[model samples]
Each structure stands twice: as C-alpha cells, then as structure tokens.
Target chain A: MIDVQHLTKRYGRVTAVDDVSFRVEKGEILGFLGPNGAGKTTTMRVLTGYMPPTEGRALVAGHDILEAPLEAKRRTGYLPETPPLYPEMTVRDYLMFVATINGLASAERRRRVETAMERTRVADMASRHCGKLSKGYRQRVGLAQAILHNPDVLILDEPTAGLDPKQIHETRDLIKSLGGDHTVILSTHILPEVAQTCSRVVIINKGRVVAIDTPENLTARLRGAETMFVQVDSAGADATPVIAAVPGVTGVTIAARRDEQASYEVASERGHDIRRQLAAAIVTQGWGLLELRPLRMSLEEIFLQLTTEENAGGAEVPRA
Target chain B: MRNVLAIARRELRSSFASPVAYVAVGLFALVFGYFFYATLVFFAERSLQATQFGMGGPMNVNQMMIRPLMLNVSVIVLFFLPMLTMRAFAEEKRSGTFELLLTRPLTDWQIVTGKFLGAMAMYSLMLLVSLVSILLLFLLGNPEWRQVATSYLGLLLMGGCFVALGLFFSSLTRSQLVAGVLTFSALLLLWVINWTADSAGPVMRAVVQALSITDHFDDFSRGVVDTRHLVYYLSFIGFGLFLTARAIDSERWKG
Candidate 1:
C-alpha cells in the first residue's frame, strides 16, 4: 500500500534520508527500528506528505506523495513525534477536528470519533482538555486522532516513546490489533516493541537502511553458530575437553562455576544439535546434567550488532 | 471549500479557547472606547465653539467625529491585529500541529485562507465591540448613519489588510512574539511610507503615497467608495495571502 523508491532528503549540507527505499504491503505492520538521528522520522514525514523529499518519490495507495499529495495524504494517517495536539481543545473536539479535515461527513465524523476514542480507550477523557491530560492520555489522544478516519495507511513516529511500561504494552497491543486492516509503519528505538508487535522490521542507521527482515529472521540470519548452555554437576572433573570432543561440538567454554556444578556455553557447527551427544558424554564421565538449553540470539543483540557494526564500518553501508 | 471552512472553524475555535483572543479583543475595546470617548468629547467642544461663532451649520459630525474615529480605529488595528494573527501559524509551528494540518488532504491555499479568514473573524469581533461604542453616539446625537456605515467599511477593509500582513509574518516564524513584532514593524513601515512623499520628486512621491495603506483608506472614510481604493485593498490582501501561501509551500521543501 506504500512504496518509497530511493527517497533522499537533504538539509543543505547534511542528508537526513539517503536513497532510502522500502515497501509496505497492505495490512502489514512494519517496524522502523533505528537509533537516534537515523532518518526514521524524516522518512515518515516524507511519506505522510508533510514534507516533500529532496529526491525520489513515494506513493500511498497508488497516489504520488508529491504530485498527488492530497490524494496520497487522504489515504494516509500520520501521528508525528510530538502528537500534533492543540492543548486547549478537549479530546473530543480535537478528534472531531481531525475527522472533519480527513473528509468525514458529520454523521460519520461523530461515529468515527467515538469509535476512535473507544479504540484508544480515551472515551472517559473525551471532555477533558488535552493540556490537562497526562502524557499517557495525550499519547492515546494522539493515536485516536491518527486512526479516527481509518485511513488505509498509518504512519506513526515513536508511538510509545514517553509512556510508562504498562502504557507501552497497551499501545503495543493496540497496534497489534490494528494489523491486517491498516498498513502501519511505526518507528522506535525500542527493540522489544518490534518483536512483540511488528511483523517485519527495518533497521536503519545514519540515514541508510542497514537491515530489513522479520525479527526472527534477522536474529537467525545473524546467528554464527548454534549455541547451548549446559550446567553439569561434576566432581572437579575437567569437562571442557570432553565436551569439546563431542561430535559436531566446535568449541566449549565454562561460563559459570558453583561448587561441583559448572555451566558451559557450547558452540556447535551450524544446523547441528549437540545436546544429546553432550548429555551422553557428561553421563559417561560420571557428571550429572542439571540443565541444558539452547541460547537463541535475542532481537536486542541483533539490533546492537547490526547498528553498531555499521557505525564501526566508518561509511554509509546499505545492507538491504 | 468544505475543507477550508473546516480548518477555519477549528482555527476560530482554538483562537477563542486561548486567552490571547479575549485579551486582544478586550484591550482593543478598552483602548478604542477611550479613543472614541476622547474624540466625541473633542468634537462636542469644537461644535460648541463653532455654534458660538455662528458656524454650527457648517460643522459636520461625520467629518469631525466619524472620520477621525475611523482613523483611530485603523491605528488601533495596526497595533492589536497582530496579536490575533501572530498565533495563526506560529503557534501551530511551535506546537507541531503544522505537520498535522499539512498532512491532511487540504491544499496550502485552503490552509492559508482558512487561517486568514479565522483571524479576520476575530478582528471583526474586536471591531464589533467598538461598533457598540459608536452606536452610543447615534443614541445621543443625530449622526449621519450613512457616513458611519462607510467609515466602518473603511475600517473593515483596512483591518483585512492588517490581518493579511500579520498572517504572512506569522507564517515566517515559529515564535509568536517575533511574528507580532515583525508584523507591527511591517505595518508601521507601510503606515509611515507616505511620510517620505514630502521629500521625493513628483513621480516618486505618487508611487510612495500610493503604497501607503492609509492613503487608500482615506477615500473610504470620506464616504467615497472608489473602485480604485477597493482594488488596492483587495490587491493588497491578495498579495499578502499569496506570499503566505508561498511561505508555507517553501516550508514543505525545507522540511
């Protein structure tokens, strides 16, 4: 539903978004993951028709963002980083104004505003002024404004930035519930949010896209070897050599030791399962196998690895 | 047109929601009331003096009271209209609602015109309060209602020019204070442009005097509805709004 082709935005001497290209399919929740100043917000701004890209083009529902901005903007809903709220207006009035501008008729505007407020769980604060609401309520009101018209595409920048943990979780759930109906592109520096809510993830850094894939796929693609953590109760027996000698075990290192129990992190050849063989070996060596678990790489590790590795590369690198 | 009206309605609502609108209108009414009273008292004194000299028949209240009162209203708008227009775009930019407005399906022209009309509505409201003060004159004296009506038309036109100029300046900055100050300065410059006509040659003098907004307003205050003055005020409004539209368009590129 959204296509961005080689979109480049520059601010005089500095390029904010450098030849960025990405596509968001209908009903797909794409997580835009990046560190600070990673051109995430800039890309969102361009896609929303809030600003024209310095180069390239973007389309929303087949409408060119620059050439047919009104049509493009009509099909897209944007929640900027700051929420774009009039503090003096009540929540209901703000949503009604958004609904009106989004081209809803009076009856539909009323129906949609109520539904939106209900969906965002902001119904109780409908009459309350936005300025008097807390940060969490304000964020919810912002979300309500974005989804009020039920546009085909939703562009949210840091939707869960300032909320507390509970509010973040609720927001993530709300976003997840929005999937399969509204195509969403939400940017955030939070890694777990992508894992929990986003179907696919785009990791950008320094004005360039470094990686784009599912969270699980990204972790799996970046995994170098199969790693397993094993805790064995051995009576002072040197278990490292024996464990390393097992078939398909490339390396073994003791990670922790507590009395007779020693934990080892074992690395096996790619696609190899050495747990059974290692357990048999430990039993034969008169050591009790207390625990055994595979160490799957987490999204946080993959994110840090990709972003920091690119930063360490000393130049712009497009991994996609 | 619907979009424009929607935006205008919201802007008008927001203006009233803030204290700025009330303070601006109240300050305008108070200052304008004082000026109207002072002018009325001065006109009464001059009329009494004229009657003592057997010149009462020659003393026109329209010229003595309504004309100067319209001029004073113009000056009052020059000072206070910026307060109404300063937050039109500057506050939106400051609070980040500019993004919301632009991301909607509305055109730049719609947004600019809506905001201009919204500010003009507030200006009209301020003028309405002063009108109530003027109506008091009709109750106590036999003032020429037609002349009063023409002077009001002049005030409205001049106020429209002020609002357009203020909107343009507001679009140029994110600081409301800067927008207010710049608008006041720009209006002051236009108001005093005719002052330099005295030192210029004949051709240059006409050009400078023509650019003076007050010079165009003079015809309306005199009950002379010249098409030339109407065209000038309309063109002035169009130019200011055109510049404001261009300013907002440039922001899209700069963003």
Candidate 2:
C-alpha cells in the first residue's frame, strides 16, 4: 500500500536520505534496519508526510505524500522515534484528542480510544497522566495513539527502543499481530527485532539501501555453505580427523576444547545432509557425541556483512 | 472546524494544566484591581467636589471610570498577553509534538487558528476579571453598559492583535523564552512606532500613526465602533495568523 520512488531528502549540505526506492505490499511488515544516523528516521518522515522529500516523492495508499498530504495522512498512522505524549494529559484524554484531530466521528471516538488502549495493553493507565507513566507505558500509549485512527499504514520508528526484555517481547507480539490489517514499516538498529517481527527486511547503510529481502533469504544467501557445530567427548583424543573423514564433510576445524570434550565446526558441501554419516563416524570411532546442530548464518551476521560491505571496495562518498 | 476546535481545546487545557495560565491571569487581575481602585478613588474625589460646590451635574461613571481603566488594560496587554502565546508552538516543537501535529490530517490553518483561539480564550479570562470591578460599579452607581461593552471589545481586539503576533514569533523558534522576548520587542516597537510620528515628516507621520496598533484601539474604548478600526484589527489578526501558517509550512521544508 506504499510506494517510494527514488526518495531523496537533504538538509542544506548534508543528504539525510539518498535516492532510495522501495515498495511495501498491503499487510506486509517491512523492517527498516540501519545503524544510528543511517537515515531511517528521515526516510520514514518523508513517507509519513511529516516532511517532504527534497527530491522525488512517495505515495501512501495511492495518494502522493506531497500532493495529497491530507488524504495520505488520513490513511497513515505515525509513531515518531520519541513517543509524542503530552505529559500533562491522561492517556484517555490524550487519545481522545488525537482521535478528534484525526477526524474520527464524535460517536466513534470513545470506542476507538478504548479499543486502541486495550490493544496496546495500556487501558489500565487510562486515567493516569502520561508524564507519570514509565518508559514502557509511554511507548505503548504511543502505539495506541497510532492505531486509534484505524489507519491503513502504520509507520513506527524504533518502536521497541527502550524497554525491559519482557516488555520488548510483548511489544513485538503486538506489532506482529498488527500485521494483515495494517501495513507496518518499523525502523530499528536491533537486528533480532527485525528478524523476529518483520516479514521483509530492508538493510540500509550510509543513506542507501544495500540489501532488501526476506529474513530467510538474507541469512541463507550469505552463508554460501552449510556449516554445523559438533561437540564430542573423545577423551582428549582428537575428533577433527573423524569428522573430516565423514563422506560429505569438506573441512573440519576445532572451535574449542577442554579436558575430554571438544567442539568442531564442520563445513559440508552445499545441499548436503550428512548428519547421519557424521554421527556414524563418531560412534564407530568410540567418540561420545555430545552436541550436533546446524549453524545457519544469523541475521546479525548478514546485517553486518551487508552494511559493512557497502562502502568497501572503492565506493564513492555521497555529496549533496 | 471540528479539528480546529479540538486543537484549540487542547491548547487551552494544556495551558491551565501548567502554571503559565494561572500566573499570567493572576498577575493581570492584580494589576487591574489596583488600577480600578485608584481610578475609583479619583472619580469619587471629583464627584465629591462637584456636589459640594454644586459645580455641575452628576458624573458619567462609564466615561470617567471604565474608559481609562480599559486603556490601562490595553497597555498591560502588551506585556502579559504575549506570555499566553509564547508556548503555543514553541512547546510543541520542544516536546516533539510538532511531528504529530504536522503528520495529522489537519491543515496548517487549522492549527494556527486553534492556537489563536486558545490564546484569545486565555486573554478573555484576563478581561473577565475586570468584570469583578465593573459589576461592583452597578451595586452603587449606574455605569453606561454600552460604553462598558465597547471598552471590552476594544481590549479584545487589541489583545487579539498581540496574541496573533505572539503566535507568529512562537512558530519561528523552539524556545519559549525567545518567543516571549521577540513578541514583547515587536509589540513595543509597534507601540512606539507612533511615537516617531511627532517629529517625523508629514507623509511619514500619517503612515506611522495609522500603522500604530494603539491608534486603532482608541476608537473602540470611547464607545465608537468605527468600521475602519474594526477592519484594521481584523486584518492585523488575519495577517499575523497567516504568517504563522507560513512559518510552519517552511519549517516542514527545513526539517
């Protein structure tokens, strides 16, 4: 429901968002992953109609963000990096005010506020002033504000930036549930959050989109070979040769060892399934197999690899 | 219009939630009360002399009392009313609510008008306190209610001008203190712009005198609803609000 075409934003001498283009389908959760100051917020700002792009444009729900801002804004909900909360207003009143400004009918405003609060799990703090709320509550209230209008597109910047592990988990679940009905585009520097919640990841670096694909594709494509970690209690006897002698094993290297236990990272041929062969080899050698698990390349490693590789190999510096 | 009212209501509600509204209104009422007492004493002394010596007929309380009292209020409006509008846009920017406001479906005109309405409401509260002193006059003597009403209209229009100008400065910066200072300076310049007329050339004199904000307010306080002054004040308010809208639009580009 969102189409961005070569959107570029510049602040005088500095280009915050370069010529970047991406499209998000209806009900898809697109994760915008980038390091801090990597122009994620700037890109989101242009998309949400908060600021117009210096060059090119974006369309939200078929309305050009620059030409038909009101229509576009009406269908999109935005939660900025810092949750916009009036510290003096209670959560209920604040949500009500947001509903009114967003042009919700008077008859429907109250119900929408309650539903939004319930969905974000901030209903208990309805009467409490936002200033007194904890960081986690403030963030949830912000989330509630975005969904209160029942907008088609939700733009959240660092939605889970500050929170306990449990709160983060709850927030991720909430965002995951928000999909299918709302096309969500969330930006974060946290790799796991993107991998866990977003259906598609857009890895950005230095104000440019270096990679965009599904989480599975990003990790699997970067691996190039199937690797496994095997730990064996060989009684201090080396098991590298035994693992290396397995039929599909191409290479074996000892990762760690202590006393009678040892760990080896075994590289296997592509499209190979050698778990049974490696197990038989270890058992026949009288080595006790402690642990054997496939080690897929994680999103973190892929993110690092993609972002770091962008400016390498004589990539030119961008100028305004 | 609904969106405008909603934003206006929030602006007024937030002002009262903080101490800014109370302190400004309280200071205004205190100064107004002191002026009312002094002017009443002066009128009482003049009436005593008229009756004792049989010098003339009874005094017109509205002319003698309420007129100068409102003039004093118009002067103080230059000082206190700017505070009402100083945080209209500055605080929103400082607290990051500006993003929420801009991204909403509402137009810049709606937000600016809402802020103006909220600040005018606060200005109205300040004017309402003068009612306490005006109502007391009815307890003992009859004041011309028409004159009283006209004086209020005068103060309202004058304060509206200040409120609009203050909103313009507030939208230009993210600092309330800076907004307040700039508003005060601008009002003071407009106040004294006429002062230069006395020594200026003939053409310069008429322009400066007509451009002075206080000169437009003089007709309203004397119970004269001159359309010229009405148009001037209305246009002044409209232009200030127009500039404020442009400021926000430009801010979006700057960001």
Output the worst ten-in-a-row residue range by lDDT, candidate 1 chain A. Answer: A311-320
Estimate TM-scores for all models.
0.96, 0.94
Q: Write the per-residue lDDT of candidate 2 for residues A233-307, one digit (tens) a residue.
A: 999999887788888888887889999999998888878999999998998988899999998777777777667
The TM-score, computed over Cα atoms with residue i paired to residue i, of candidate 2 is 0.94
Clashes of each: 0, 0
lDDT of 1: 0.88
Candidate 1 CAPRI classification by DockQ: high
Model 2 off-target regions past 4 Å? A234-250, A280-285, A311-320, B50-60
List, residue by residue over B1-255, the lDDT tens digit for candidate 2: 999999889998998999988998899889889999999999999999998997868787877888888777788889898789999999999999999999999899999999999889888988897689889998989878888888899889988999999999999999999999999999999988998999999999999988999888777778899999888899999999999999999999999
Q: For each candidate, what's the DockQ?
A: 0.88, 0.88
Clash count, candidate 2: 0
Residue A163, candidate 2: alpha-carbon lDDT? 81
Off by over 4 Å in 1: A311-320, B55-57
